[model samples]
Target: MRRGMRPLLALAVTLGASTVAHAHSVHAGLSADGRLVVSAAPAAGLTRFDPHARSPPHRLPSAGGTESTVSVLIDHAAMESGLAPSLLRAVVQQESAFNPAAVSRAGAAGLMQLMPGTARRFGVHDRFDPAQNLRGGAAYLAWLLRHFNHDTDLALAAYNAGEGSVHRHGNQIPPFAETQAYVRSVRRYEAQWIRKLRAE
Candidate 1:
């Protein structure tokens, strides 16, 4: 078996046993196995796999403990877009830890940790601008969702590593420990979000 198949196989094996719960008021459901399983409700929006799953879920520190400008920006954007404040918070936290002024060794910057080229493409003049940075990051995520056909895991893997890396590996999660862990972390959070949505 190819090494890339390991994670998928593992996921399949674990799918039937996992259970998630969360506290929130939303309309959605998650399967016992952890795949995004939604109930038949009109209010529940579309659910599908994304092809260009590239970004990973960022882990942020707790609020009121060590707040940062990037965290505030992400929270504001999530609120404005109605895309789950916690999800955005988690993404940014994992990406840059709410560092509005963070610059990755690879040149990713700002709250969402936008790459220099990505920032320019998104028309963001200043990655430090909280609003602009969040908007660009969110926009990039939306693009990735479309690219990956809504497969959250794939999209996240691509985000952490790069779309090229995912493609080079035959559309599988790349062989990077950080990227792999990032996907799992985001999926766990997403599961929680879905659970909360369903409980409501």
Candidate 2:
């Protein structure tokens, strides 16, 4: 498939109404605070990765400056990583809103809000560099997808809350408010991007 069409194709595969419904049913029930209600506290010994919990969430930036350039980079990374461009866009939006200079309070940086360890693990030398950051983030997401057997919700949960947190919670989304909201927001953005791509 053409690079441009990959998002559309993934839309068909990943963005069905059933996905959202099932996610709500399986990963999170309807909590008044939108937190994941669990029968027990999350297991111990997992390093919780919740950057957004420390940093105030950023609104999507107005499109200008690096916007077009970031789109190109996202497409290139998506192509090389075999990830959906819509999903990449959604992650970038949720992470840094396309700001390559963005850094979270917890020390995550760049468009993907990669931590120092994650950047190094993904061979991302310059996390402030848009291309490298997107590449690293996409590669990590792809690996998470495989690690979680292509379960998008689990992969997304791992993205926000760490793989160990998911495993600690018995291969489920960790019972964290921020992580649950992060997964929900990213999925919402992915769906919006898919709809826009289909319209275009």
Candidate 3:
């Protein structure tokens, strides 16, 4: 097995046993100050209940220059989903270049560059809504992660090109130039974000 597969397999094992504590830069949950907050659940198990009700919540930073509203939502969703925020940011950067108002030639919209059909399937009525759009996009990513057995590269490729294309090619990374480039870019960004997070 490849090196990447090892980590993914470990993650699968951990996930199978129970949800692991995800290292998140931003903490989500209820605020002690009586403000609304989104918190992460315990690392040991998956709970359908909202984790935001916990305590000692941190405020989410506002979107800044070059940071679209969708990116913020994606960040929050990643934290809430127990996924890596950097990974979400990297995917968003590759998908829409952090443009919340971006529209693909193929009719994908919002920060994550979700297609109309996909957005609908994810129950996103307003693709322009940052929170809804991020939730939809992150949910889709989570689905892809599970589908690809946590293979980040393949999952990302599928996210860009479509699962059908990947499956048609024997579950291998499709040879499409755009898809390949997208994966590489996302990986690069993921690495960068991971470094940034470690630095903090």
The CA lDDT of each predicted structure is: 0.57, 0.70, 0.63
What TM-score do all the candidates reach, one by one? 0.58, 0.69, 0.65
**Which scores greater on TM-score, model 1 or model 3?**
3
Worst 10 residues of 1 by lDDT: 17-26
- What is the per-residue lDDT of model 2 for residues 19-55, given as tens digits with 9 covering 90 to 100? 4323321111213543333221233321112212344
Name the top TM-score candidate.
2
The parts of candidate 2 lying over 4 Å away from their true place are 1-66
Better of 1 and 2 by lDDT: 2
lDDT of model 1 at residue 37?
Answer: 41
User: What is the C-alpha lDDT profile of model 1 across 21-63, one tens digit per residue?
Assistant: 1211112323455354433332433222111123342322222
State each model's C-alpha RMSD to the native: 18.1, 18.0, 14.1
Residue 147 lDDT (model 1): 82
User: Which is the better candidate, 2 or 3, if ranked by lDDT?
Assistant: 2
Q: Order the candidates by TM-score, highest first — what do you get? A: 2, 3, 1
Which candidate model has the greater lDDT, 1 or 3? 3
